[model samples]
Target chain A: MKLKVYTDRMSQPSRAVIIFCKVNGIQFDEILISLAKRQQLAPEFKDINPLGKVPAIVDGRLKLFESHAILIYLSSAFPSVADHWYPNDLSKRAKIHSVLDWHHTNLRPGAAGYVLNSVLAPSLGLPLDPQAASKADKLLTKSLSTLETFWLKGNAKFLLGSNQPSIADLSLVCELTQLQLLDEKDRVRLLSPHKKVEQWIENTRKATMPHFDEVHEILFKAKQRFEKQREMGTVPKPGFQSKM
Target chain B: MKLKVYTDRMSQPSRAVIIFCKVNGIQFDEILISLAKRQQLAPEFKDINPLGKVPAIVDGRLKLFESHAILIYLSSAFPSVADHWYPNDLSKRAKIHSVLDWHHTNLRPGAAGYVLNSVLAPSLGLPLDPQAASKADKLLTKSLSTLETFWLKGNAKFLLGSNQPSIADLSLVCELTQLQLLDEKDRVRLLSPHKKVEQWIENTRKATMPHFDEVHEILFKAKQRFEKQREMGTVPKPGFQSKM
Candidate 1:
C-alpha cells in the first residue's frame, strides 16, 4: 500500500512534506485536509491525527503528525531518499536537526504569525490586529536576519551552510513563502534587507524544481486572489480560526 | 578534552540535556551560563550558540543548540548511550520526534509562559501580568489534559505507550517542573484534573533516577524560596529575562 499523506497546501509544513516526497520519488496519495473548510477538525480526521492538524501520514497501521517527524521518517524509512537530505553521518544530521527544531520556534512563528494576523485573518473569519502584525513583523525580521547573518554567513548555498539542500532547507524555505501573501510594501519591508536569504530561497527552489513550484501553486494563487480582493476593498471569510 | 555543555539550571531544557548525559553516562564538563546575570548574552557564549540560548554544547568543534537536537545528537553520537533513549528503529524514532516538535508550540509555551508571566517574572526582573498568566494557564490545562487522554492512554508506562522513556519524555517532564514554581492554589488548580499526567511525570522521573532529582534541585529550591518570599509579602528580582 502507498503511504497516505493527509495535508493542506495552505499549510507551510504541509507543503514541505509534499515537496520532499515528490523530489525524493516517494510514492504517496495526497489527501487534502482543507484548513479553510475546517475539515481537519472532523471526527474521522481525528483518528488519523488526534491533534487535528495537517501534514499527518498513515504508513500501514502507524499514524503520525508534525511535518518534521514525517519528513525525518520518510528520509530514513525510504531507501530511495537521497542521503544528503538527512545524512546518516551523526554530526551532519544533528546540525540539520538543529535547524529544523530552530525553525519551529523561530522562523515558523515569525512567518506564520505575521501572515495569520495580517493577510489570512479575514479569509479565516478573524479580525486583523495591526499591533499584533507589527509585533510579528519584528520577530519575522529578526528571524530573517539570523538566517542571513549566521545560518547563511558561510559560502554554502543553504542554511547551516550546506552546499546541498536538506530537509531543513525545504522546511525553512517553505516558511519564507508565506511572505508572498503579505502586501507588496509589508512583504518587501520584512524581507528585502536579507539579500542572502533571498538567494537561498531561490537556490532551494531551483534545487527542488518543478515540484516546489507545483506544490506551491495553490499558495501563489491565493496570494493573487487576496490581492484582487484587497484591490476591490476587502476579504475575510472568518468562519473559523486555526494555528496555521 | 571533555564535551563542553553550556547551560543554566534555571532553564528547563538545560536541565534535560545535563540529565540525559548523566543518565546515559556521557562524561562532560558542565559550564554554567547564568540566565539571571544576563551571561547568555555575553559575546563568548554567542560563539557557542548564535541564538544565545542555554543547553548548547560544544562537542569538539561542533557547536550545537536546541535541547531536542542535542538529545538526538547525543544518543546517536555517544557510544555508551542506550538505544531506548532514542531507539535505532526508524518508526520509533519518528514518533519520538513528533512529540518533541509538538512540545515547542504546545507544552513549552504553555508551561514556560505561565511561569514567566506569573511566578518567575519578578525574580527575573520583569513585571507579572495576571491576565497573561491566566491565558497561559488555559493552554497549560489543555496540554496536560492531552497528555493524559492521548499520549498515556495506552498500557505502556510512559509516553508513546513505551515501557522505556525516550528523550521526549525527559524534555517534556522537565517542562512540567516549571509548574512547581506556581503557588499551591494555582499549581493544584492547573494540575489536579490530569491524574494521568501527574503519574506520567513520576514515571519519567523514576526512569531517570538520582539524576532527575539531582538536576532539578535548583528548580525545586527556587520554588521554596519563592514561597517563603511570598508569605513574607513577595518576590520578583526583576534582574533580566530568559526563555526558561
Candidate 2:
C-alpha cells in the first residue's frame, strides 16, 4: 500500500505535504479533508489525527499529524529524498531543526493568524476584527524582519544560508503564499521592508516548481472568490468560528 | 569547553533543557539569562538566538535554539543518551514528533498563557486582563481534555502509549509545571478532570528524578514569592512583560 496523506490545499501545511511528496517522487494518495465545511471535525478524520487538524499521513499502521513532523518523517523514511531536505550531518540538521521549530511559534502563527483575521476569517467562520488583524499583522511584519536581517542574512537563498532548500524552506514559503489572499496593498505593506525575505520566498518557490504552483492553485482560486466578495461588499455568515 | 546552555529556570522550556542535560549526564555550563530582567533581548544574547528566547545551546561551533530543537539535537548528539529519549525507530520517533509539534500551539500556549495572565502578569510587566485569562483558560481545559481522552488513553505511562518518556514527554510535562504558579483552585479546575494527565506528569517527573526536582526548585521558590504577594495584597511591579 502506498503512503496516504489527508489534507486540504486551502491550508498551507497541507500544500507543503503534497508538494514534498511530488518533489521527492514519493507515491501517496491524497485524501482531502475540507476545512471550509469543517469535514476535518468528522469522526473519520479524527481517527487519523485525534486533534482533527490537517496534513496527517498513514504509512501502514503508523498515523502521524503535524506537518513539520510529517515532513521530517518523509525526509527520513524515503531513502530517495536528497539529504539537503534534512541532512544527516549533526550540526546542519540541528540548524534545520531550529528553523522548523522556530516556524511553529513565529512564522506559522504570524502568517496564518494574519490571513485568517484579515482575509480568510469570513469564509472560515470568523468575524472580521481589525484589532485582531492588526495584531497578527504586526507579528507577520516582525517575523519577516527577523527572517531578512537574521536568518536570511547576506546572499543566502534559503534559511540557515543553505543553497539547497530544506523542508523548512518549503514549509515557510508555502506559509507566505497565504499573503496572496491579502489585498495587494496590504501585502505590499507587510512585505515591502524585507527584500531578502522576498528573494528567499521566490527562491523557495522556484526551487520547487510546477508542484508548488499545482498545490497552491486552489488557494489562488479562493483568492479570486475572496476578491469578488470584497468587491461585492458581501459578508460571510456569522457564528461557527474555527477556534482550531 | 563543555556544552553551554543559556536559560532561565522560570521559563518552562529552559528547565526542560537543564533537566535533560542533567538526566543524560551531558556536562554543560549553565548560563542564566533572566527573563524577569529582560536580559534575553540584549544584543549579546541575541547573538546566540536571534529569536531572543531561552533554552539555547552552544555545542562547540553549532548554536541552536528552540527547546524542542535543542532537545532533539542533544538526544542525537550524545550517544550515551539512551535511544528511548528520542528513539532510532522511525515510526516511534515520528509519533513523538507529532506530540512535540502539537505542543507548541496547544499545550505550551494554554499552560503558559494561563499562568502568565492569571498569576505571573503583574510581576512580569503587563496588567492582568481577565478576558485574555479567560480565553487562555478555555484553551487550557480543551487541551487537557484532548490529552485525557486521546493521548493518555489506557494504561500508558507516557504519550504515544510508551513506557519510556521521550523528548515530547519531557517538554510537555515541563509545560504543565507552570500550572504550579496558578492558585490551588485554578490549578484544580484546569487539571482535576484529567486524572491521566496528572499521573503522566508524575510519571515523567519520577522517571527523570533528582534533575527534575532540582530544576523545578526555582519555580517552586517563585511560587512562594507569588503566594507571599497574594497574601500581602501586593502586586508585581509593571513595565516589562516578556512578549516571548
lDDT of 2 by residue, A1-244 (tens): 8999999999899999999999999999999999988989999987898788998999999999999999999999999899999999989998888888888888888888878876777777778776666677778888898888887867878888888899999999999999888766667777888888888988988999989898999988987887777677673322212231
lDDT of 1: 0.87
**How many steric overlaps are in each model, in order?**
10, 0
Fnat per predicted structure, each in turn: 0.91, 0.84
Check candidate 1 and list the clashing pairs: A122-A236, A123-A236, A124-A238, A125-A238, B122-B236, B122-B237, B123-B237, B124-B239, B125-B238, B125-B239
TM-score, every prediction: 0.95, 0.95
Tell me the TM-score of model 2: 0.95
Candidate 1 docking band: high
Tens-place lDDT per residue, model 1, A1-244, is 8999999999999999999999999999999899999999999999999889999999997789999999999999999999999999888898998888888888898888889987788788889876666667778889999999988868889877788999999999999998888777667777789899999999999999999999999999998998788677675332212222
lDDT of 2 by residue, B24-123 (tens): 9999999999999999999999889877899899998999999998999999999879999999999999988888888989888888887888778878
lDDT of 1 by residue, B99-212 (tens): 999899989988998899977887788898776776777788889988989888677888898999999999999999988887767787788898888888899999899999
**Each model's DockQ score:** 0.84, 0.78
What candidate 1 gets wrong by more than 4 Å, as runs, is A235-244, B235-244
